[model samples]
Target chain A: MAEIAATASKRDVGRGRGLVAAIAWRSLWRNRRRTWLTAGGIAFGVSLVVFSMAFQAGSYGDMIYNATSFLTGQVQIQRADYIELSRFEQTIGDATETLRRVEQQAGVLSATARVEAFALVSVDERSFGAQVLGVDVERERQVVNFFDRLSRGRVMAGPDETVIGSGLARNLNADLGDEIVVLGSAKRGGVAAMVLDIVGIFDSGISELDRSLLFVPIAAVQNEFGLGDEVHTIVVRTQVDDSRAVVEALGHQLPEGLSVRNWDEVLPEIRQGIDVDRLGGMFMYAIVLMIITFSIVNTFTMTVFERLREFSMLKAVGMRPGKIVLMVQIEALLLWAIGVGIAMGLMVPLLAWLQSSGIYLGEAIVELAKQYYITDRIYPALGPASLLAAPAVMLAATQIAAFASSLRIYWLRAAAGVRAAE
Target chain B: MSSDIVVSCKGVSRTYQEESVPVHALRGVDFEFARGEFVSIAGPSGSGKSTLLNVIGGLDRPDAGTITVDGVELNGLNETELSDLRLHKMGFVFQSYNLIPVLSALENVEFIMQLQGVGPAERAERAMSMLDSLDIVDLADRRPGDMSGGQQQRVAIARSIVTNPVLLLADEPSANLDSATTEDLLQLLRRLNEERGVSILTATHDPIVMSYAQRQVNLRDGAIVEDSAAKVA
Candidate 1:
């Protein structure tokens, strides 16, 4: 009895190993071109995912940095009513103490209080609208390097001095040292107007910001607009690594009238825009992957059909149907592994070039990007997640395709397979 | 009836359903094969020789009646049991030399032993011995496609007897071979039956195959027409 059991186990192991080797050899050599082609399809699908994801990551990183550095700081604190209502009435009466409290918070790196309003700027005949930001030059410099981004003249250093973005300057035909008139309603109501010399021209690499921001000294804005000890918002910066935690902590500690928001909250429209762009990218990738999967399935089905006779012969010699299925599955896995390996091999060089040189679209595409997404050059950056996820996705997709085709082989009747040969 | 009968069939019948039409391939037939017997079932086309062989080999079940091989009643066993019976107690050879083309000659013979749960080292030893007995040991490493039709058939024969089955079934084993190859195969079958004590039942229309059998059963339209023990010296 024991000898029978021992023999049975030994045969099982031998058959298992033989089955694996047979499947591996059949998968590679029987349909050489088709095997390589299927592998190519998987490789292409995986590479697209990896490259596109890396590009999106890089683009989003750029957008976030530009948005935050151009206007809002890493974090912003405002009256709770101001964020919900966005009305002029929600301005804080005493921003000085609030600014002090924010700066004292753990992980708080820098803090500044500012007033903001929307108005029109005109130089001679040309006129354009702009968002007027009131800032303390030194504190504002600590949060955002508006002065460092100047293309013409110096940043505002006095109460009456102002800096205009390059696009805003172009729209209004205003130049450095030229006086531009700003017109809008003051905080109290009636009318408010100011004429200030353009001290600097800044370019933030974002069309929306570059085309419509005018920065001036807070005292000057206060006097011209009758703001009377009120500030619109307080911008804060935290240590980079601890920014999210700092924002969450500050959000819970703020008083009822005040609200703190991260960069994402401050720019909901931009975030939503990015999310839509990401969805579109994902949809495009999915379409490409589906086509690749179909090609692979077709190749595998043909391979199986061609080898029908051989499989029957194996079965006749006591090969189990389940073992046949396992053999085919192992073949698929080998194909996937090879495909992913080739893609990884190709991607390393391609990604390096893309990261260093960037992807150059034609002038027309660049213009379109400027008109819509506000950037001309597309830079792809490698993220760990994007790099590692490509092979996994390919393996899963190929395995599914292989398993679906393997079922036909598994359910094949041994007698029927042999009958054709007879 | 001798108690030494290794195979006994009592009124066995097989009907196949083809496209919703019932085709009676075999009528009720009774037969018996003794241990270590070399037997042949001779018939023309559609005479139920292959069907009868299939039932005895446990590759297919009869629609009615009982088949007992070495005391195990085949009709009483389920599909898995029948598979186990085939794996352990029966081996098959086909006219087409149905050997997996991807496997070498040695691997083909080793397959049955593998299925029987033999270890690799021992399976190789036994398979090599079988190939040596047939004088095809030199072609052990060559795949079936690389060898001649006769060599492939020899491998198939080796595969059949590797597990030392209680019964070996061959269906038209010489139909695709030349006269010389057929004679060589017949000599091997004769030696295996005489020397190894393995029971073999072959279904063939060839007179050359019938000449080697110790007993011959002739079938016509699914019924046995003649049963004779060969007059051997």
Candidate 2:
């Protein structure tokens, strides 16, 4: 019996709430043109917000993926001075052992060691300074995309064998099965010199990488450099999109001379580029939305004044001042919902079309990509945050405007309000 | 009918600040209305008839006197408490803008009941019954804009009485009505007062409204000049 009575009482309260909400919602449609104009402002603001956010997010992903795939891995275990100096003396003494330990880390998918040195290569009276990367033939593929990125012969077959980049081969006038002289100042005692056979050549489409890269077996690099057991860097690939977890996990457990550097640390310039772009996007969003807020305030203030008599009638009819505020906020939310819905409707198709046909960055970007190792085509990605944040900000800003304008209504005296001119 | 007082005022005075002058709308007035009695405050424009009714209805507070409704001091209650009193106990009929423009005739009636937390089924039933009694059941779904002046007044009456309020205050309700409509509205108020035992107060300059009151109070320049009991029609 008590439960039944309680349910009935709750039902009555709910009925009252439903009626209040219905009245508020109906009030929005009373001035259709004003409502549409306000909704249009929100749509314009949020469309820009959504488009910029999605573009920035997608561009960041592409840059990170390309940067990591082409050159850097997710994390790098390197000597403390190797990044800055690149000196042969600053080598990881037990790089193979470090690679084994990193591979066993929780999120680590694969790991490879490399001994890189700036060496002079000569073939048939032509010579060029090339960066020789001594790598494990099988393990290097798991870290970088170089193995599958081949155009000519395969990866280095054995010791004293090398795979030269097409640009470097062209510069040195070298061909497949040609023997090239490579000389480097070894860290131990002597000048390291070798006549290595070029068994393969490759083109990665990145002109910088193709211009000055040569790959040889790590064992050969160790023997030639007179450093039998040391490699300069150990690169690890994590199984996840973010490497922070793996980097933090292994940072504390590494040997005395080694530190774990994630992609951001290894490539701070790329991280800064993404950060600057994100900040620019947010700055644009804030400016547009602040104008939208003022528009809301102006729109609602005019509405509140025009409807003073109506509000006064409602007050006389026993509508609370707080409910009046809620009614205005409901109007704001309704406008936001309509605007965001339209923007999303328009954005989805546009983004899909752009995604299908990747955005061409034009001549400047294409030249920059050729000059550096950057990719030309950017595929913008839309994340869940962009999908959620735009509407959230629009509604919040509009509600604040609505609340600020509705404050004027609470000061409306019922007696004067009833007599106030329409 | 019982003669217990529903509204009482003592030495009620109000001043209005208009530009640079203070206009005394009401001055040291004492008044009382008994339960179920229909009284009309009649005067010319700016004679404080509206101000007196506004004070009695808790829509405006007296600056220098006390107004009491149903044992609750009007000056002592906060805005929210006063709103609750009006929602549950008092009804109003304005001279114009009586109905919310967006609401239908039926919905306007249900709005009061809904605000009072009446069950949906009960609110709809009582609203329909009120519309039926007012002879406007066919216009239940018609919005206020679609209704004629007379028809809208009838709908306003339905809304006012649907809650069964203890006091029904009408301020110049017949101001915009034609003579025939004024006569009809006055008769309807008389019927509601007699049938439902509702205490009625009306502030108006309309002679038609003044004629139907059980008692009439006359005001001039913010002071009551005469009080007399008149025969009910």
Candidate 3:
């Protein structure tokens, strides 16, 4: 029957989303090269952001872990005036009890108490002032990262043995097993002096940490200075993710005179340093995303301009101008999804390899990094946040451009647009 | 359907400012059609044939006149309202089959119903049925690029009536078709008009179209010179 009917055909129907997406899909495939190129730009942009973000976070993680775990433990309990004055008189009296309390606290990984004193060390009649850290042998090993920074003979073996800095040893012209005399003021207002064997030497990449720092057994330093069971500070290592909880618990348990300081509080400068680094990284992310957004705007704008007839034809077929705009936006979003999907696919394996093997920037950086109390190897870290963040930013950015380009549709006359060639 | 005037255009005037010269496309034209009529507006080029169709189909607004389609006034409707009105009540067939190129022929047919809020299964079934009526069901899944000129026009016609619009407006629908295809199209349209009682308004200079139309609207210089009703042989 060759017949047409304008009678209502009644039945429930769905706008097969399959059909619409298929059309969108087909439209993209029509110009596969351009589609790929546009999508490629987004993928490359996202990947760069992801890679850089992961790299920065990884490096910072290493630095923080090393600095807090070794050079300065995550949390430090000190006599309130010890950090400011560094005088032996402002010491924590009976620090062993405080150390025992902190060590038993939940989330506290390890703790060490130290008697820090400034003294004069003389080698071959050449004397130089040095900062000596008197620590318990087993506790010191547990509290600090000695493996990465110890470059010479070994850690201290006896109360009479001392570990000096590479720069200090160089200046003293001292070798392992050589004896040096340490002179300092005893707590009872008397001159105290002792001769110690140099058992080990450490080279921290930072000139300052290596130049004047030395480690000695707590017994020997206490005997030399005549301070009995007195320590300047207690350094505690806390679980990184649990530091807040640990700090809260520590506040309630510690004695009145000993003050607990978290890594952020202990190294506000380093915190600021990290914030600055993050700011720089974020700036780069913003710049890259902006460029990608404009590229999307330009590409979709040209697409809208070129598909004028298609848009108008859609309007003629009873599609609203707003709907036409939506179609364009959806198209851009599809492109974004494609790009971000490709980025995630490639980055997953890439990041895993980087985090495992690590990137060695240079020997100089590796060496210098030890001064900050972090490792020499810098790894890339792609966290869940960055995995979601890069794509989401790209998606939102591309959508903004898609919407902006779609505004042109509102101005297009269906009659004129249906006749446009391109 | 009753003989109510499905479309009524009275004293419709349209003037276009073409770069500086004002061209009067339609000048005080009066026309109307009942619900189940097959009418043609026949004229030479520049006789306001397409212009008259555009105004009646709610595609173009007249400068001075009132047009009522399926009881809705086109004069007061906004762009969106007019678009909705067109989507549900008025369907158009352009001289060049303007099927969305990316859509399959069946999707092109389903386009109007999709816009009219028809569900997928129903629109698909209806679109297939519509294509069957036009003898182009085989071309349903083929995009316009892959279809012949005749098949594309069939798909265009199918798209126009898929929503069961009150008025089907054709502006030279057969302009690009060969004589045989034109005959086939007219015959299919004639069957639709006679059996299903669809009202059709076509603007064309083709003699074959005039032969199929029950009523002929003759326009000269944007005004109706003669309005005549005749029987098809």
Please list the C-alpha lDDT of all candidates, in the order they appear: 0.80, 0.83, 0.81
Interface RMSD of each: 3.5, 5.8, 6.5
Tens-place lDDT per residue, model 2, A1-422, is 23323443454344466666777678888899988888888888888888878777777777776778666788898888777777788888866677788888888888899998889999979999999898998888888787777788877778989998999999988899899999888877689998899888888776787989999998888888888788888888874375889988898788876878889888888888878878887888899999988988898898788788888888887777777777778877877888888889998788878876878888777867643344677665677887778889888888888898899778777888876632
User: Candidate 1: lDDT over CA atoms?
Assistant: 0.80
lDDT of 1 by residue, B42-73 (tens): 99988999889877876667889899987778
Error of 2 at A155 (Å): 4.9
User: What is the CAPRI rating of model 2's predicted complex?
Assistant: medium
Candidate 2 residue lDDT tens string, B1-233: 12388888899999999997999999999988888989999999999998898888778888988887776677877666667767767899888846888889999999888877787899899999999988899999999999998899899888888988889999898888999989988889999999888889999888889999989999999999988852232
Candidate 2 clashes between residue pairs 3 or more apart in a chain or in different chains:
A58-A381
- As a whole number from 0 to 100, the lDDT of residue A181 in candidate 1 is 92
Q: Compared with the true structure, what per-residue lDDT tens digits does model 3 show for residues A1-422?
A: 00111222121123334556666667777778888988998999999999988888887888777777766778888878877877788888877787888899988888998888889998888899999889886886687775357788888878888988999999999989899999999988898888999988898666787889889999888888988888888888876667778878888887776678888898887788889989988998999888888888888888877787777777666667776676677788899989998998898899999889998778777656765545767888778876778889988888888888879788776766643431
| Each prediction's number of clashing residue pairs | 1, 1, 4
Native contact fraction per model: 0.28, 0.56, 0.33
Minimum summed lDDT over a 10-residue window in model 3 chain A is located at: A1-10
- Candidate 1: the clashing residue pairs are A11-B117
In candidate 1, what are the lDDT values of residues A1-422, reduced to their tens digit?
A: 23333444454644556645664666477667877888888888888888888888878876776567655787988888888887766798777777888899999888888998888889998888789999998998788765677777887878778998889988887788899999988877968899898889988666688899989899888888988778989888765447688888888777776777888788787789889988998798778778887887886677677777767656655566566667777787888887888888988789888888887777878756643444567787787877877676666777787778777765565555665677
Ranked candidates (lDDT, high to low): 2, 3, 1
Winner by DockQ between candidate 3 and candidate 2: 2
